[model samples]
Target chain A: MQDPFELSPSECEALLRAGVVGRIALATPTGPHIVPVNYSVVEESIVVLTSPYSLLGTHGRDSMLAFEIDQFDYEYHRGWSVVARGRAEVVTDPAEVERIRKTWPPRPWASGIRTLCLRIRWSELSGRRLGTGWQPMEDLPVHRVV
Target chain B: MQDPFELSPSECEALLRAGVVGRIALATPTGPHIVPVNYSVVEESIVVLTSPYSLLGTHGRDSMLAFEIDQFDYEYHRGWSVVARGRAEVVTDPAEVERIRKTWPPRPWASGIRTLCLRIRWSELSGRRLGTGWQPMEDLPVHRVV
Candidate 1:
C-alpha cells in the first residue's frame, strides 16, 4: 500500500490554479457549512463571484474559511487534495473588483446574478497526494478547466 | 438562465446513497476545515473510517459538522449538491461497528489506519440542483456509486 505524501508549495499552487471548482467551508452560528463554489486564482489569492445577500456572501466576510480542491480517480484509487485556510473578504472597491474581474473573472456554473466578488486571503496552504508515484500533470485527464 | 431548485428528502437520500465520496466540514479552534472522505450511508447516518488521531477524527466528536456530496458536469454546466448537517459521534459499539463494516465498509483511497468509525446523525438535510429542467436519475452519469 502506498502512503499519501505532502505536496510542495509550487505543486499545491499549480493544482489550485488548474482547478475550477472547489468547496469553501465557513463557520456560522448554526454550524460549519461546506458549499461548492467556482473559483479562480488571482494574484496568489482565491476569488469567487457570489451574491451579496446569499448566506455565504454575507457571513463569509472577514471570517476564517477553508477552501479545498481535489481530483480523484476512483478506478485507480488515486487522488490529490489541496486545502487553503484563510480569511475571506468582500471586494468592495470598484476599481479593484473590476481589475480582478478583468483578469480572473469567476463564471459560476449555477445560474445566478453573482455580482459580489469574495476573496480568500490564504494564510496556510497544504496538500496531499494518494498514490504510488507522482506523474507529470499533463498526463492526467483535465476534468474541469474554467 | 436556469434557477436552482430544492431537492426533496427522498431525492437527497437517494443521491447520498449513490455517492461514494463526500466532504466533511469541521470547525476547529483555528478555523473551519474541509476535507474529502470516503463515506457510506447506514440507517440514514453517514459513516466514515478515520484515524482517531487525525484532525477530523480527533476534533469531530460531538461537534456540529456538515457533509456534502455533489456531481457537476462542466460541459453541460449543470449539477446537484446535497448537504447533511448534524453532530458527529464516534461509533464505539463493537457490534454496531462490526455491522456497519460488514454492510458498507469504507475503502479509503488514502493510506491510513482509519480504525475509528465516525457517524453523523444529520438534523438538517438540504439539496439543490442547478438546471432548467430535472431529468430522470438514470439519464445522469453515476459518478460515485457505493
Candidate 2:
C-alpha cells in the first residue's frame, strides 16, 4: 500500500459538503465526548442542529470543538478523514437561521426537538487519505442532496 | 420514526467486543482531537496500539479520554453509538503485555510502528440505539476476530 497523503483544502471542503454525518469532539465536564451529528457545511463552518439539553447542546456552545468526517474500509485498510477545529457558537440571529435553513441546512435523523443550531467556524482544516489508486471523493457512501 | 432508547450494559459490552474500529476522543494542548484507532476490548477496558509519539500517546497518558464506536444506516436515519469514558494508562508491564498479546490484541490497519499500548479503564459505559426491530450487535460492518 502507498503511504497516506494529505488532502487539499478544496478537497476537504468538498468532502465536508458531501458528508451527511460526522462526529463532534469536545471537552466536557466529565471527559472528552465524541458525538455523532448530522451536519452541513455552510460558508466553511460546520452547522449542526441538536437538542438544547443534550450533551452537545449543553457544552458545545462557544467551546473549542473538533468536527471529523471519514470513510474507511476495514477489509482493505484504507480510508480518508477530514477534521476541522474551531470554536463553536450558537446561531441566535433570526436572519442567520433563515439563511441556513434555505441553504444546506442540517437534517438530523433522530427523533427529538433539535432547535439549537451550533456553528463551528473552523480555524484549522486538514485531512488525510490512505491507500492508493482510489479517489476519496468517489467512495462516499451517502451523497448530500443539493 | 421511533425515539432512541438507552442500551443495556450487556448490550453495550457486546457491541464493543464485536467492533473492530473506534474513535478516541481526548483533550490536547491545542484542543479536542478525535482519531480513529483499531481497538479491542479486554476485560471491559479499551486497548489500543498507537505510535509512541502520536496524539493518543502524547496526551492520553493518565488523561481522561472517551472512546466511541457506532454503526449507522443513513437511508433509514437509524443507528447505535456506544461510548466509554475513563482514564488511559500505558501498559508497560511485560507480563501484562504477554497476556494481552495472547488475547484479542489490537491490529492497526495503517502502516506505522505502533508499539505503545494505551488502555482506558472506563468508569462510564453507556449507549443509545435508534430505530426499531433491529439489534445493534448484529449491525457491525467489521466483526472482531476472537
Candidate 3:
C-alpha cells in the first residue's frame, strides 16, 4: 500500500461540493455527538436543514463544530477523509436565507419540519487519502447534482 | 416514505457488533473532531487501535466520546445510524489487553504504528432507522469478520 498523501485545499473543497451527505461533530453538555445529514456547499460553507428540536439544531448553534466526509473501499483498503473545523451559525436572516436558497439548498432525506438551518464556516480544512493513483472525485458513489 | 423509528437496545448492540468501521467523535482543545476507524466490540465496549499522536489517541484519552456506525443507500433513501456515548479509556493493563486480544481485536487498515488501544464503555446507546420492512444487517456492504 502506498503511503497516504495530504489533499490540497482546492481538492478538499471540490470533494465537499461533490458530496451530498456528511457527518457533523459537536460538543454537547452530555458528551460529544456526531450526526449525519445531507448538506449542500454554499459559498464554501456547509449548510443543512434540521428540526429545531434535533440534537444538532439544539446544541450546534453558535458552536465550534467539525464536519467530515469520506468514502472508503473495504475490499481495496483505500479511502479518503476530509475534515473541516469551524463555528456553526444558525441562518435566520431573510437575506442570507435567500442567498442560500438560490444556491443548492440542503434537502434532508428524513421527513420532518426541518425549519432550522445551520451553516458551518470552516476555518481549518485538511484531508488525507490512502492508496495510490486514483481520483476520489471520479469514484464518488453518487453523481454530483447540479 | 415511512417515518423513521427507533431501534431497540438489543438491535443496536447487534448492529454495533456486526459493523467493522465506526466514526469516533471527541472534543479537543481546538474543537470537536471526528475520525473514522475500524473497531471491534469486546464485552460491549468499542475497541480501536490508533496512532499515539493521532487525533483520537491524543484527545480521546480518558475523555467522554461518542461513536457512530451507519450504512446508507442514496438510491433507496434508507439507512440506520447507531450512536454510542461513553468515556474513552486507554488500554494499558497487560491482563486486560490479553483478554481483549483473545476476542475480535481491532485491525486498522491504515498503515501506521498504531500502538495505542482505546476502549469506550458506553453508558448511553440509541439508534434509529429510516424506511421500513428491510433488514439492514443483510444489506451490510462487507461481511462481518470473525
In candidate 3, which residue ranges exceed 4 Å CA deviation? none
- Candidate 2: which pairs clash? none
- Sum up the clashes in candidate 1: 0
Pairs with steric clashes in candidate 1: none
Expressed as tens digits, the lDDT of each residue in B1-146 for candidate 2 is 54889999999898988887889999998889988888988897999998889989899889999999988898888999999999999999998898889987887777888889999998999999989988887667888766
Docking class of 2: medium
Give the DockQ of candidate 2. Answer: 0.67
Regions of model 2 farther than 4 Å from truth: none
- Model 1, runs deviating above 4 Å: A133-136, A139-146, B133-136, B139-146
Output the TM-score of candidate 2: 0.96
lDDT (Cα, tens digit) per residue for candidate 2, span A102-132: 9889988888999899999999999988898
* Fnat, 2 decimals, each candidate: 0.79, 0.63, 0.63
Residue-level lDDT of model 1, residues A76-145, one tens digit each, is 7777889999999888999989898778777788778887889998899999888865552554444444
* Candidate 1 docking class: medium
TM-score of each: 0.92, 0.96, 0.96
Prediction 1 TM-score vs. true? 0.92
